[model samples]
Target: MFPKAHQYVNIHAHRLAISQDEWVLTNLFAGDDFPGANETAYYSTGLHPWHIKDADSEQLIKKVELAAENLKVLAIGETGLDKLIQTPLDLQLQVFGAQVEIAERRGLAVIIHAVRSYNELIEFAKVHQPAAAMIIHGFNGSFQIAEDLMKAGYYLSFGHRLLISDKLKDVVTHIPAEKIFLETDESEHGIRELYKVVSELRNISLESLKVMIGENVKQVLRIR
Candidate 1:
């Protein structure tokens, strides 16, 4: 049988767990070395758009494909468009699309890293319509954008941005429990703190929020 859900589910994190209570889905950027055999944490692997210009993307994608064979590898990204970067949108699309294809083939969820490219991301989803759950990590968009993405059948994951962005707080309050997740996402803030903030915003008990997100991780991400 698969493991039961833990008290805290960090959907996207860069570091290993600081405590056993947290089930951290660590992000492994392609081209980086894989964790040691003794490592005991879930991971999402893909070619990050920012590193495409600096690395052999095809080789890195091959690495991702190999990594996906490991049951510890639960999702296919931290891969998506980033308009703020110098990487051409076309190249980003090509690379991101490749990773999405892997997720579709592997029956895994996708942890997306979008930046000022939601419209294009939505269009891409409409066209390809990947079966894997597309989770937009560290989402800081307006309610309308969130609604549109949800309407297109995507999930929103809030991280450190939830602490400072009033707009994001509003988004969290209304996002359906089943479609929402929380993460740390390379930030200094703790996942537990983010959970507390979200519980208050949604006017639900902290325990209830934890149970809901745990179930979402299992059902939406299909993690046993």
Candidate 2:
């Protein structure tokens, strides 16, 4: 899957980019408008835990399942547990489990949005043993947590937090190229900048990083 690519692979991002050189997997929440299909643009759709306060959970879950039928929909979420929010943990788990089932059944990856519940997520993974790759998007957690997830066969995506957190930088350097991904994930920074930072941290060429992440994308999304 490493096609000697010069393009950046943004595994997860909220805003769409017009760049022809980059491959952006844009995230569409359950109610968001699904953009018309394009060659460079792909998407992941699910109900986010934060926005589920007033949502009709079953309806949105059905929407995610329907979206999974689209070829361009490569992943199931931007969905996972978050303890900081007021949403009940039980409800979050229920909604998250439903999305995971969709991804697993469809053979797609699951992009996760975890906040202060990494352990819970790990436990969930152990119990469910989901076949779909679980990627922790916008990961700023400790190296131990990163290692634990990686050991459990989960991938970690770095975003704005990598720019500010020295600890996260160390984690990035230690993370295997195949298990690492860089994302914008609602950040203002360009994906290229994150790539540059990571390449420098890992002491590898920018092209190498591009190819590494491109392959990681292929592996996680089961792209040919």
List, residue by residue over 93-141, the lDDT tens digit for candidate 2. 9999999999998999999999999999989988989889999999989
Model 1, range 1-224, lDDT digits (tens) per residue?
12245468889999887887788888999887876545677789898888887358889989998888777788998899999999899999999999999998888899999999999989998998888899999888999999999988899999998899999999999879999999998889999999999989989998888889988887756553
RMSD of 1: 1.7
Best candidate per lDDT, number? Answer: 1
Q: Give the residue spans of candidate 1 off by over 4 A.
A: 1-6, 36-38
Pairs that clash in candidate 1: none
Alpha carbon deviation, residue 55, candidate 1 (Å): 6.4
Tell me the TM-score of each prediction against the true structure.
0.94, 0.94
Q: Lowest-scoring 10 consecutive residues by lDDT in candidate 1?
A: 1-10
Q: How far is candidate 2 from the true structure (C-alpha RMSD, Å)?
A: 1.8
